[model samples]
Target: MAEITDTALQGTSKSPNTITLQEFNNRIKRLLADPSVMNCWVVAETTDVRINQHCYLQLLEKNPKTGATVAKIKAIIWGNQFRFLNARFKQVTGRDIGNDMKIMVCLSVNYSPQYGLTVVINDINPEFTLGDMERQRQEILNRLTQEGIIGQNKTVPVPPVLQRIAIVSAAGAAGYGDFMKQLTDNKYGVCFYPCLFQATMQGVKTVPTVLAALDKVEQNQHLFDCVVIIRGGGGTEELNSFDNYDLARRVATFPLPVIVGIGHERDITVLDYVAGIRVKTPTAAAEHIILQAANALAHIGDLSNQVVSIARDYIARAKEQLSYYAGNLPIMAQRIIDTNTLRLQNFIQNIPLHVQRRIEGENAQLARQKDAIKNAVAQVKMKETMRLEALGDKIELLSPRKVMARGYTLTTCEGKIMTDAAQLEAGKLVTIHFRDGKVVAGTQSVIKDK
Candidate 1:
């Protein structure tokens, strides 16, 4: 440590005094080392919290209304103290010191020539943060109630069979894996189509990423029957984001029913209140869906059995009807045959007498027709004989022998008979014939009549 002088503390601009960096820091250290102000409790919001072997962070005291920082200080916790304080805080509040956390911490002011001013945190009042968180949560609940949206999702009906699911979760989280495993390996062999919309489930990004995931699910709402927000296997610090007003409101009014299972039994968030269905763990959410599907399947099986029973009953009735008809068929057929046989016997007895009467009448009618035919044939023969005799007389009057006998002579030239002078030539042979004689002579010159 360097020496401090009175001149360094009181100096004019004309003769300015200088002090070594270590000397200046040593003076500040002495002032802060007072017993009254050395170790005390301060309430502030945590910021830039980094935890490892030791914890390093900033404490911020802000104006309540404006939310502008009024005081800021560098703070840290040594490895051993941080372990004890964090363990105790987690046990009490279900959370460790995290960014934006309101805390009342017991700290001692420290200054070093090399390290400047910083507060060393020794213990924390977990109840203070816990109370503040509860107050904020209540305020959110009141706002949601006033808006009348806190029970909106609860009003949506979960489908009897939850086949398609829109899941908002960290893709690789142990909770998501456990949920999928339980659904896949259920004893009832139920199937689920769980499409994951990945989001950060913890830390500063939790609220926005989850809200974005819900928006995506909304855009494709037709693909899912319900929404499942599952963040299994995370500490209570991670659960704080689920209490956010914006995230809770979004879940409460989402179009599809939302199921929240964040894997915490001791701590419940505002989300649990707003969600349609809330369960302790991802496995429980899976089991709920499986049970619904199993019930629906059982219902379907029962309906199928009922249909089979009805069909069997119908078939049994049809068989009885057929059997009744078969038993009466032979008697009905025999009665019809006996009636027809009696009618045939009566018709056969009248057949011979009817034929005999018909034959006698036909024979008398034939005798009458024979006499009429004989008269017609005799009249026709007499008419034809008179016509033939008149023809013979005409033929006798025109005969050549008859003409010659009546003094009409016939002349012939060689074998042809000549009736004209043009048929005769000088010195041609001629023949003249009378009734019973013929003369042959040499012809003289024939003359034409003038």
Candidate 2:
């Protein structure tokens, strides 16, 4: 046998010859950088994936058949490739590829003769990414349904306009930017005052960060009209965080209506089910606001038009009434004039004729009265003359001279005509009266006139 040298001979030295855990891990990382035995494709279920600040990932894969884990690998995704991968995954699936996702990845195997083994990812398939997202989505939906939070958010009332908005999203996501821009640019005079409750929009920390933001919004309840959870563009994997039962409960029981604009068109999440309104994208949510405002404006315009029409109708009616009265005015004036003129003409025609007729009748009556007076005076004069003539005749007949001429003598006694002889009895003295003269005689013989 060859002489045992210091290098060849084995001895249990006082100090151990093996490397420390830290040094071994560093050597394995260095070996992973080699090009030969490291390159391969892995189809595995990611049980755990932790992303560090430096963009390195720790991945663990498990076997689905045995329910036993078969591979554990330390993986790295450089910042540039990580960003591209993240963007691409989100563009395809509307989510981020993270833990609990089954992926077929192109990786480089890293083995160190001194240390251990690891893997580094180079490329990813987007279809597998969507598959992973659908699986997680189903799981979350089942969980939320079991917990009774899915139905609650659907029952909330959505305000006509979400004027005060509490937004939970990554601070500078394009979706958030688009939403804000659309709201601000609204033509319907809608004003949105958004309270930004920033959070991680993707990855393992998304659920906790978003929940924290929601809690903050809840605490400051006076600041918001409704809550909006928006992720502009991301893989559906990121939406898995929203399916958490606790998060769903928080959204369902929020003091205000919660509006979700997750921008994933393929499937609805538990958060969507719980929200008062679910919009497919941030821009679509903005469009809803615009539509509401447009409707209000149209209603106001209709009212204004109706008011104007009513006023116009009233004016027209008043004008028609005025025209009716105006048309009747001339007829009324003509009737009054014609009535007065006819009365005047009748008076004028009757005045002189009535006066002349009355004067003629009076003249005829005066003539008749004059004729009667004349007749009465004549008759009285005639009667008086006749009586005088008759009286003269009687006097002539009774005259003494006439009696004498007729062979008759008159005798009288005591200067009175003697009509009886008996009155002359042996008287003392007697006088006789004749018609012309009287005589006094003594009685020689008594004689009687028979």
Candidate 3:
């Protein structure tokens, strides 16, 4: 692609004011070397950026809609200044000064007979690059958000117990070691099975290698509870790979929950926002898993304690209830028996007095009839007294109170009457109801007659 420069002196050769092309280019270069044009700002979009001995940049202005170049210029950044300038550019914008970068470069217009015309770029304003980066990042993030990809991986729930973990990182990285130590050998003595799917943690191969590792984990997804990505041991000087749009899309829409620990203390990568969970360092991510195991143990311990305590409390309450029944049962039964006995005794004493009064009244009536028939009256009075005495004895013999008083007793157990001798067995408790009182007794032994 040819550079856009001043046209050659075609008809100016006839004019003496313009000399040969070589002399004319040299004179024009000398004139443009003023204080203002020697080192001034130029805004253009970079096209071809090649780096061998020196950095070569092809700057161009393109039609916004048509994508056709409207203007083009050649630019160069010396190798001597590339180191500090590239570092500063990446630090401020979180990306390298690469092709298609909209930049503001400080350059000097140079015209040479051999090299034609070019711009010698010496300095750049990183602020422009930063603004452009922000704009691009915002656009990508917004598109992802609108497409509803941001929460796709977030919807996958992390398993309650973290045992199998598929890790993507450099195999011998310090970050990986720290994560393993924190997880497998935690203070709680929890064991974790960490499988390493090694990948390049940084540089050009970072995104592709990590994505490949993720794909492998996905293939064996059933074997793992979750996926963890850990990268530490270096600064975020080349962390733009983490913010790659393609990689971010894959991570944000993963089938399983993704845990990222990229070890960046400065700006968060787009991966961090799209991941199911993000931690500052690999060890911190490990701690989060260990905490889950610890909490599970704690929850189980609490439930066990609750069950044992409840059982003990139930047994104690049952014992108290049994003791209450045992202590009050006999006393209540005895009180009822005593009241019935006292009423029966009063009725028996009144019966004898009433019989004596009835016999005296019969004797008085016979005496009044003695004046008419004295001999028959004496015989009749004796027969009547004898009959009354026999009736009183029969009544006394038939009474339940009298029957019990004659060496007979009714036995009951727990308030139920016992009718058979079989009911009187060893270890069986019974109450004996006598004529005057009752006795509660537990059977120590049973005796049977042949």
Candidate closest to the true structure, highest TM-score: 1
- Writing each residue's lDDT as its tens digit, candidate 3 over 224-287 gives 9989998884544366678788888999988878999986566577888899988888988899
lDDT at residue 329 of model 1 (Cα atoms)? 87
Q: How close is candidate 2 to the true structure, as a TM-score?
A: 0.49
lDDT of 3: 0.85
Clashing pairs in 1: none
lDDT of 1 by residue, 313-395 (tens): 99999999989889988997898899999999988998998899899989999998999899999999999999999999999
Tell me the RMSD of model 2 versus the true structure.
34.9
Candidate 3 Cα deviation (angstroms), residue 426: 99
- Candidate 3's C-alpha runs over 4 A off are 1-25, 31-40, 44-91, 94-102, 111-118, 233-237, 325-450
lDDT (C-alpha, whole model) for all candidates: 0.90, 0.76, 0.85
Which window of ten consecutive residues has the lowest lDDT sum in model 2?
47-56
The Cα error of candidate 2 at residue 25, in Å, is: 21
- Predicted model with the maximum lDDT: 1
Runs in model 2 lying further than 4 Å from the true structure:
1-100, 103-132, 146-148, 219-223, 235-239, 264-269, 322-450
Better model by lDDT: candidate 2 vs candidate 3: 3
